[model samples]
Target: MDKNELIQKYFEKSLSPEEAAMFENLLADKEFADEVAFQKKIKKVITHEERATLKDKLRTFENQKTSTDKWWYAAASVFVLLGTAIWFMGQKPDYDTLYASYYETYPNVIAPVVRNNNDTITDTEKAFAYYEKQDYNKALEIFQTIIRTSPQEEYAQFYSAISYMELAKFSEASKILSGTNWSKKYADDAIWYLALLELKTDNPDASRKFLLEASKTSRYQKESLELLKKLD
Candidate 1:
C-alpha cells in the first residue's frame, strides 16, 4: 500500500493488522515521521468522529496533482489547532460551584427577638427580625436608617452588607464591606464574607487577597487557608 494510503487508514482507524505494520515501517522515514507528528497535533483538537472526516480530506488532498495544496491544508489544520488551544486556555474558572459550596447568609447575632416582652422593640431588633426571616430588602431599609442615625453601629453596617449580598447587589455589598471599620466582633467574619463576595462576582484575585488576610485572623483562619489552596 502507498504510504499516504496507510497513514490515512491509520487516522481513520480502519487499518488492518498488515496495514498497521506498514504504517509503523513508514514512521522510520524522517519526513513520514514528521507528517505523523503533524497529524497528532490535529488529532488533539478534533473529536473521534471528526478525525474520520479529517483523514478522508487529507487523503483526497494528497491525491490531487499539487504538493502545495497538501502543505496548505496541513498549515490550516495547525492554525485551527493553535486557535483551539488558546480558546481553552482563556476559559475562566467555574464560579457557580465555588460560590454555592461556600456561601451562607450571615446570622442575626446582634438582636434576639423576645416574642412577648413588655419592652418596646428597637429599629435594630426590627431589622434583625426581617433579616432572620430572609426579607433582605426590608432588613436593608431599616439597617440603612440605623447607619444614617448612628454611623458607628458596626452590627448595622455588617448586616447591611450581608443584606446587600443576599439581594445579589454585589456592588453595594462590596462598598459597605470594603469601607466599614470591622470591630473585633466581626473582623475575620467581614473579611471572609468579602472573599466570598469576590468569588461570587468571578473576581478570584480579589477573593484570594481577602482570603489571605482572613487567614491571619483568629475566627476564619482555617477556612480561609483551605479556600486559598483551592484558588491556587
Candidate 2:
C-alpha cells in the first residue's frame, strides 16, 4: 500500500498483520521514518488550527446579537475549556511551585519583654530577634529552650514550628503545630501553614483536610477554598 494509505491504517489501528509488518519495515528507512514523523506533526498542527478557527467562528456568531447568541457563547466556552485541559495535560507536577505560591513567613506577634540591655534580654527577645533576622536555626534553638520553661508560650511554640518549616523540616513543624491547642491566637495560621506544609511534603490528602479545616475559619475561608479548588 502507499505511504499515505498505510499511515491512515496505522492511525486507525486497522492494518492487517501483514500490512502492519510491511509498514514497520518501510518505517525502517530513515527517509520513510522522517516522512511519517512530518505527517504526524502536520496533522497535529492542522487539528489545532481547526480548533482555533472554529473558536473564532463561534465568537463571531456570539457577537451577532441574536437569541441564539447564548448557544454560541456556550459553544465557544467548550473550546476555551478544551484549551485549558490541553494546557493542564502538558503541565508538570509542581509541588515546589505551589508551595512557593502560598508559603510566607508567619508574622511575629510576640511582645518584646525587654529592651534596655542585653543582660536583661529574655530568650523570647533573643529568639525573636534571630527570627526577625531570618536566622531560623538560632531562633529554633532559643524558642525550644524558652518553650521548655514557658510551656504555654503559644507564640514560642508557633514560631519554633515556623523555624522548622523554614528549615524544610515539615514533619517537625506539623508535629509542633498539631500538638498546640487550636484555640490559641495562631490557630487559623497553624491550619493554613500545616495545609501548605502538607502540600510541600507531598501529602495531598492531609493537605486537603487541613485546607478544609482552615476554610472553616472566617479569616482563611476564601483563600483556603481557592487552594482547595487548585488541588482538585
Candidate 3:
C-alpha cells in the first residue's frame, strides 16, 4: 500500500494484520516517516479548525434562540473547550517553558562586613550593591575577592555561586552548590539551585532527582512537586 493509504488506515485504526505489518515496514523509510508525521500535524490543525467552526455555528444558533435558553449552549461550549485545552496542555508540556516559569533569581540578603569605624565602603560592600542591582559581572569580581579574604563565609559562597549562574557559568555554580562546607542554613537554597543548574545543563534526569530529594524538605516541596508533576 502507498503511504497515504497506510496513514488513512492508521488514523481509522482499521488496518488488517497484514496491511498493518506493511505499514510498519514503510515507516522505516525516512520519506514515509516524514509523510506520516506531517500528516499527523496537519490532522491536529484540521481538527482544531473544525472544532472552532462547529463552535461558531453553535454560537450563531444560540444567538438566534431565546435569551434564557441560549446560555446553556454557551456554557456547554465553554466547558468543552476548557477540557480540550487542559488535555492539550497535559499532552505536550514544554520542559524549557516550564523551567522558565518556575525559575527566579535568588535574592541576596547578606550585607558586607564592616571594614573599619570610618564611613568607607569596602569592596565587599560594593559587591553587595552590585549584586542587589543585578550587576553580575562586578558582583562576581567582588565575590571572588570576598571569597579569597574569607573562604569560610557561606553567604559569600552561595551568592558567588548565584553570580556564576547569572554569568552563565553553570558548572562553576554547580561546584559551589555541591560544596561541603556550606552550613545547613543554605542547604535548601543550594539544592534548589543545583536542580535548576541541572535543568539548564540539559540533564533532566539529574534535575528530577535533585527535585525529588529537595521535595522531602519543606522549603522547596511545593515547587518541586509542581515541577515533578509536569515532568511526569
Instruction: Indicate the worst ten consecutive residues by lDDT in candidate 3.
Output: 108-117
Q: Which sections of candidate 3 miss by over 4 Å?
A: 1-93, 112-117
lDDT of 2 by residue, 1-232 (tens): 6675686678668999999999999988997787678546545654676578677867776777577567867676778878986798577557788889888898777744445554677777788889989999999999999888888777788899999999989889989988878565778899999899989988776776687678768998777776765664
Best by TM-score: 2
The lDDT per prediction is 0.78, 0.79, 0.77
- Check candidate 2 and list the clashing pairs: none
The candidate, 2 or 3, that scores higher on lDDT is 2
lDDT ranking, high to low: 2, 1, 3
**TM-scores for every candidate against the unseen true structure:** 0.58, 0.64, 0.59
Arranged by TM-score with the best first, the candidates are: 2, 3, 1
